[model samples]
Target: MLDFRMDTFLAVCQYMNYTRAAEALNITQPAVSQHIRWLEEQYEAPLFTYANKRLSLTREGELLRSMALTVKHDEQMLRRRLHDPGPGAHRLVFGVTPTVGMSLIPEPLARYHRLYPDAPISIRVSNTESLCAALDQGELDFAIVEGYFCKSDYDSLLYRREPYLAVCGAEYQFEREPKVLSDLLGETLVVREPGSGNREIIRRALSRENRAVEDFRSVIQVSDMNVLKKLLLLGCGVGFLYQAAAQPQLGQGLLRAIPLEDFQESHDITFLWRKGSVFAQRYRQLFELLSPQDIEGESCAAGD
Candidate 1:
């Protein structure tokens, strides 16, 4: 078990103010200072510093914060494990990007339910950054994400490799048939908001060409996948998405592919959890149960 003072440390990390941390922990401001001082003494380093009058973590502090967060999450899981009423007492908590949640979740969830029909499950759909933060905070057991994440901070299993696609409405036509994205630079670009995995993927791809989403005549950011697809199908604008996500619509000729000569790109959809999670083996088992088939796109088993 970790020292209870880690709670105070995390609170300070959250609020960045001793007074607020103390108030949240129902302790005095001086007590919060003492807790921090004690931790600094034990760790033999200052954990925080002020720059431009704003409190921020020191290198040592960042390292401690990462380790402490894992401890906190592990403690929470330990409590849940100890007090669990039996099978299905605790819902299986996990997250997925909107693309995966929309296209890949149902079949695997059905498979899980068939195997353990009484098990409760909770699914959170959000962008990659938010999902990773939730995993660090112990709010989620795992995530299926398609964006960039710090490989050093998490353990991952390669879920699938999905090709990126640029699409417009079936009736929409580019002025030059868009052999490259340069031909479509004048059209509006419909994209997911910041922190979304697919959006980041395209952003990096564009940067390689000395361009950006801003290079488009206009840009519309939508968090809802359905609305984004509707806008595309209505010829409102062009959008980039994973092939799996657009498979049904493309097959139906609702969304037409714009084969940008520059965009021969694909991204890995990964199953992510904390680097040193106590429940890693258990999560790996669940990954196996869901990984073999059931997803609509191509997939293969990945090593730990």
Candidate 2:
């Protein structure tokens, strides 16, 4: 179990206000202060500083916050397994970015479900940033994300390297062979919403040409992957997405991939779990179910 003092400290860190933390913890404000003072004395370092009427973690406080998070997760995991162990006793909660959720994870999740029909599963699909936040809060067991994140915070495995492609309606006629960013910039561009992995990937790729998404002639931001694909198919705009995601339309002669000189690159789809998770080894079988090589190899075969 996490220490009550540590929990009190975390509440303060979260709210950054002594009164608010106290109210949330159902404790008195002075008691909250006492707990913090005790913690500071034990650690022999001030954990927070009040400057300009704002509370902020000092460098030492930041270190303690990190350690506290790990300790909290360890305690939660221990309590969960201890309280619930036996047939059909565990609930697995995980997260995924929209791109991975739509294209890569369905089959493996289904297989896992079949194998452990009694173990309830909860999946949260959101942007990479949101997914990582949930993992940080210990709301998820793990997450599968695309684009880039702070890999140092978790234990991760590269599940797949998926290529991003420039796509358009099959009937849309290009003025010229698409060779550069300029060729596509004049057309309306459909892109993922901010914080989405696909949008982040496109943003970084555009920076190589000293451009940004705002440089496009017109931009359409769609939060749902299905809606984005629908817009592209209806010729609402040219879009960027994983090649495997566009495969179905490309095969049906309803969509065509426009080759880009600079944006032709792949990003990693990674599986992330809390660092030093007690359940890490226990969940290895889940990783085996979502193997990137196996998933993509089969996708390629189907495409061929």
Candidate 3:
């Protein structure tokens, strides 16, 4: 069993408030303080600092937190190994963002199912932040996320790099060679909500140019890319989307991909699995099926 004090320290680090941590642990505030004090005494250094009623981890605290996560993961793995039914069946849980879930996952998942018909599969569709957190918490066997790199402890490989395109109804008109960034300020922008990896990418790109999302005249905040595409087809507003995702609408002349002078960049879609996970082989097989060459040569070839 892991040390109880270490568990308390981990909880405190997560919540960043001793009172809140105590409440979460169903213990008294003084008990939380006592655990921290005991841990500090054992380590011979302060783990955190409190100032102005705000708490921040000390350098040592950050290191300890990382170590605690590793310990927790290892403990969980041990428990699973001891309790798991031997060679019967297994379920794999995959996490994905909505955009990738819609555009990229179907074919590979279908292939995986055909190949491993006995293995059960579960999927969780969420924003990138939630997907990453789920991966950390050991709730997912692997995840496919957009625009973010996996942490050092996890093994991550770039699965796809798809171009982001400015999309709008085919009827939308623009001046001859209009400035992409400047002209977008006047248009009604339809964008994903904050915390989405797509939105984060846009935020970072705009930040480089000393601009922000508020600078745009946004008309809608959508949660799903498919819904956004539907709205764009209805001539509601312009939005940014992965070229592969917008290809169908583009083919039907329901929407057009506007050429952006400086916004011609690709969003890297990454496949992530926990370091030293037992399901690594299954994840690798799935990744090979999802590899760009395989996917591009398969049913979605024309779309790509």
Better of 1 and 2 by lDDT: 1
How far off is model 1, as Cα RMSD? Answer: 3.1
lDDT: worst 10-residue window of model 3: 295-304
**Residues 177-266, model 2: lDDT tens digits:** 778777788888999888888899888888887889998889999889999999988988788888878888999999998887666687
lDDT for model 2, on a 0 to 1 scale?
A: 0.80
- lDDT of each candidate versus the true structure: 0.85, 0.80, 0.75
Model 1, 103: alpha-carbon shift in Å?
A: 1.1
Error of 2 at 55 (Å): 5.1
lDDT of 3 by residue, 1-304 (tens): 5699888998898899988999999999999999999999999999999899899999888777766665565565456545545554444567888878887888777776776677667799988878777766656667888856446456676677788888889987654445566678777778888878778887888888898878877668888877878888877777888877888788988898877788887777778766655555666776776555533322211113
Q: Which is better, 2 or 3, measured by lDDT?
A: 2
Model 2 bad stretches (over 4 Å): 11-34, 49-56, 74-85, 88-90, 292-304
- In model 2, which residue pairs have backbone atoms overlapping below 3 Å? none
Could you give the C-alpha RMSD of every candidate to the true structure, in order shown? 3.1, 5.0, 4.9
